[model samples]
Target chain A: MSLLEVRDLNTFFRTKHGIVKAVNGVSYTVEAGKTLGIVGESGSGKTVSAMSILQLLDTNGFIESGSIKFDGRELTTLTRREMYEIRGNDISVIFQEPMTSLNPVFTVERQVSEPFMVHQGLSKREAALRVLDMLRDVRIPNPEVVTKQYPHQLSGGMRQRVMIAMALACRPRILIADEPSTALDVTIQAQILKLMNDLQEEKGTSIMFITHDLGVVCQMADDVAVMYCGQVVEMAPARTIFGKPQFSHPYTEGLLFSIPRLDTPSDVRLEAIPGAVPHPLKLPDGCKFAPRCKYATERCKVEEPELVEVQPGQGVRCFYPDLKERRKDG
Target chain B: MGKYVLKRLVYIVIVFFVISFLMYALYNLIPTDPARAQLEPMRQQLKPEEYIRMYKQLRKEMGLDDHLVIRYARWMGIIKGLKGKFDGLLQGNFGYSQTFKKPVVQQISEPMKNTIFINIFATIAALGITLPLGVYCAVHKGKKFDTTVQTMSILGYSLPIFIISLIFMYFFVVRWGIFPLMGSKTPNATYEPGSWEAFVDKVYHIALPVIVMTFASLGGMTRYVRSSMIEALGTDYIRTARAKGLREKVVIYSHAWRNALLPIITSILAWFLGIFGGSVIIENTFSLNGMGKLYWTGLNTLDFELVLAIQMFYTVVSLIGSLLIDLSYGIVDPRVRVNK
Candidate 1:
């Protein structure tokens, strides 16, 4: 069994206008010690689907239908109390903005060591020592002094390092990183990604890395799931997805084309996927990508495509999955 | 931190000087004379020449004849208190209260003590109830408990203390005769200050006023706490806390509450300092001999000296309260620490 398996997950939120289907029939798996990158634009349900695994949605949001099995244990069926035991123990999360993700009033030691004190049943002194070691593992400078300082006392990159330390302190089996390095600058972003990669290797931890950046996915993911408008339109191994994908959904093709690279000719314009992400409440009836897809057919506008495996370890959710023919039609 | 406090202390001195000077000048503008008001009852008995002589003598003795600046300087002891004897505010002379027929310091000391006692009790009661109530409301937000607490808070906030005090007096005092209606204690009771009887009597008399005081601010304080907590709970840090596997209780109290406490502390300090002023309507309605009632009587009888002293006392209290708040910010949140 995969370390974490989410099958046909559907999550919705209660809003005044109507229920918002935030995550619609999403399925994925993170194998032991492997990274699965869930890449999408904002509001594409990447974060929500991850949150559903932990049952940590806001009060207004509810999992309408889903089965999340973490190491053969059905997470959706677990009591809230049981789920809490798994959080920060079996699985942990690192958020986007490090500056705001830590309580400003608490010391770094308190924030980082609390999981140890709670789950490991360590005394305060023991937790403090563990926190220092965890900080050291994250390559923080002067771990002793950093542990005593508050969140605001540290720089942005340093704070994110602290967050990473806190999340990985328990040596969680699975780590969910929700746009972890998106808020960081280029240099800091590279360092943090490297740190997470090293940590994952050291502990043999599985990671569900969520981001909108294809570049980040290329660097971090073993497998990639491309989400568009609350649904994963394509799934394949990272090499297959990035290197001559056999059955690429039009949305996935557009995402790949949008990447600006140093090797691209100067005169050639970078292709941006056209149109905004459809609002969750007012999503189109058929294939969600059809509205923004250059090669969308009349049939594509009328009938939604179900995700199907066209090749081994690869899935595409479009009627016209061939990239060459679709581009020629446009 | 020490340097910040010392700097704040100097600022407090400057603020007090400006406030006291304005108060004294404003008092002089009132066109009322302590001597003439005192002599009004005996005006018909004295000849015109004798009245004139008494007025001049009283003015000179009271330093009313001196220039306002000179009088202020002497009062603060920058000019006076230089000899072997000291007769200024620096020497603890708050002047005399003509209305109470005693030294200003003596007249105010007991009332100040009573006011502080009543207010501190009320504040403790208010916060003790509201802090937990606010946290509960925030945690169970959108539930029945939160809705009920929010409704009660709105009602408490809107109803004036005077109205509430009157209702309490009518029901608990006039109708039921279960609680004392007025005064800090029974007028002629001889129980020692620390004795049980004296304490009970003081509690009995201050009960209605304290309840009124607590209710008056309870709504605002609870709302402040609730909103602050709610905001904190929505922050990314709070999500991080929950993601740490901390129970809901620990998340709310240990994580969310710490950040929410800063604003709550500010409001608490404001309320604590307000104790010296006393609740005017509540004091008057209950006929308690607290600072509010004394200030009311002093103002009505044109006792500027007593009014001036009370104003100065309030100014000093406010300055000290603000300074404490500034220093406490560093303790509560290291981000604002001046030394760093």
Candidate 2:
């Protein structure tokens, strides 16, 4: 069985104006010792889906319909008290901004060792030892001195590593890294990603990697799920998703074409996605991405497509799956 | 760090000297003659020359006959422990109060004790009520509890201290006949330290005024704390704490409250130093013989020496309070230090 399986998860926020369907019927699974990347634009509900899995949605938000099963146990049915036991011990998450994520008042050692203290009930001395070890594992030089220093005293990259150290300290079965390196510089980003990859290899940890950067996704993800407007538009093996990418969903094609490559000449104009992601409150009927899709049709405008299998291991939600074939047929 | 603290101390000393000098100069410049005021009711028939002679003698006796520069120098000298009849600047005898007909420092001592007693208790009571309620309102924001607290805080803020005092006096003291209406104690009260009867009497006398003072001050601070708590709760670190699977109490108190308290702590210190010492209205309303009342009396009587002395004491107290606040900032928030 998969370590973590999210089935038809729906999360919405109750607001003054109306209820916003932030995460609508999103489903995916992470097998043991593998990486599942959820790629999308800013409001594509990737982060919300990940947060919902841990039941960390904001106060106004509620999971309307979902089944988050971790290790054959239903997470959605668990109480907050029960979920607390599994959160740090079995499932860990690293947020986007490290500088803000780690409490400024606490020393790096205190934050890094908190998971061990919470989950394992490790003694202070043992927690300290493990914190230092994890810090070293994340390739932070001079773990002894860094442990004693405050968050503000360290640079952004160092702080990110400390966040990672804290997250991985309890040896969780699944690590959900939500845009972990997005706040970092290019060099630091590569370093952090490499560190995460190395750790996953060493621990055989399943990872739910959420990011908009397709390059990083290409580098790290074994499976890719493309989300658009609160729903999974496509899912496939990473190589097939990138290489053969069936040019069916115009949204996916736009996302692929928008990625700038070094091989492309500097003078040549790059392809850009035409419109912004639709506002969640005013999401269009039928296919949410229909308004932004180039291959949108009358049928697409009236009917939502199911996430049906197009190939053996690939799923595409589209009314006109063979857009190229349709053009040839025309 | 040592150098930074030393620099701050020197700044404090300079501020102290300047304040003292200003108080001294301003009091001397006032048209009212302290000697004439002292001798007013006693005078049956006195010649101008006699009055002038008596005034000059009194001024000379009080060391006020010296030049402005010289008097300031002497005051600074006393403060620095270089030359003064007293052991040091703050050691008992600064000068005698002509209006009160007693040693200025000695007269202030009792009133100061009363003021400290009332102010400290009231402030502690206000904080005890405000802190938890403020935090709860912030955490449960938009809930019925939060709405209720916000409404109460607004009502408390709107109601003036005098109005609140009158209401309490009416309900608790007059109608209920539960507590004393005014004064720090009943007539013919004698000191009996550690006695339960004495403690109960003192508490009864102090209750109404303390309640009035607490409600008057609680609104602003509670609002401040609530806003700070809200800001702390919205911070990324707080969300991270929740993600860490910590209980709500642990997340709110240990993570959020500590960070939120930096601003609240400083404001509380300021309120303690400023309001407690300057409670002239409350003291008069309650008929409490506190430092505020003493200052008010001294000012009304044009007792320059007594006024100047009280002013100087208040300035020093304020300076010390602020210095302690700055030092505590470093302790509470490790990120802040003497240097930055």
Which portions of model 1 miss their true places by more than 4 Å?
B35-61, B81-85, B187-195, B273-278, B338-340
Give the number of the best model, judged by DockQ.
1
Give the poorly placed runs of model 2, Cα more than 4 Å off: A265-267, A326-330, B1-8, B35-67, B76-92, B189-200, B337-340
Predicted structure 1: lDDT: 0.87
lDDT of 2 by residue, B163-250 (tens): 8888888999889998887887777877686588777887888787888888888778888899999999999998788787788888
What is residue B130's positional error in candidate 1, in angstroms? 0.6
**lDDT per residue (tens digit) for residues A18-102 in model 1:** 9999999999999999999999999999999998887788989999998999999999988879978999999999999998999
Error of 1 at A53 (Å): 1.3
What TM-scores do the predictions have?
Answer: 0.95, 0.93
Reference contacts reproduced by model 1: 0.77
Top-lDDT structure, candidate number = 1
- Give the lDDT of residue A238 in candidate 1: 98
What overall lDDT goes with each candidate model?
A: 0.87, 0.84
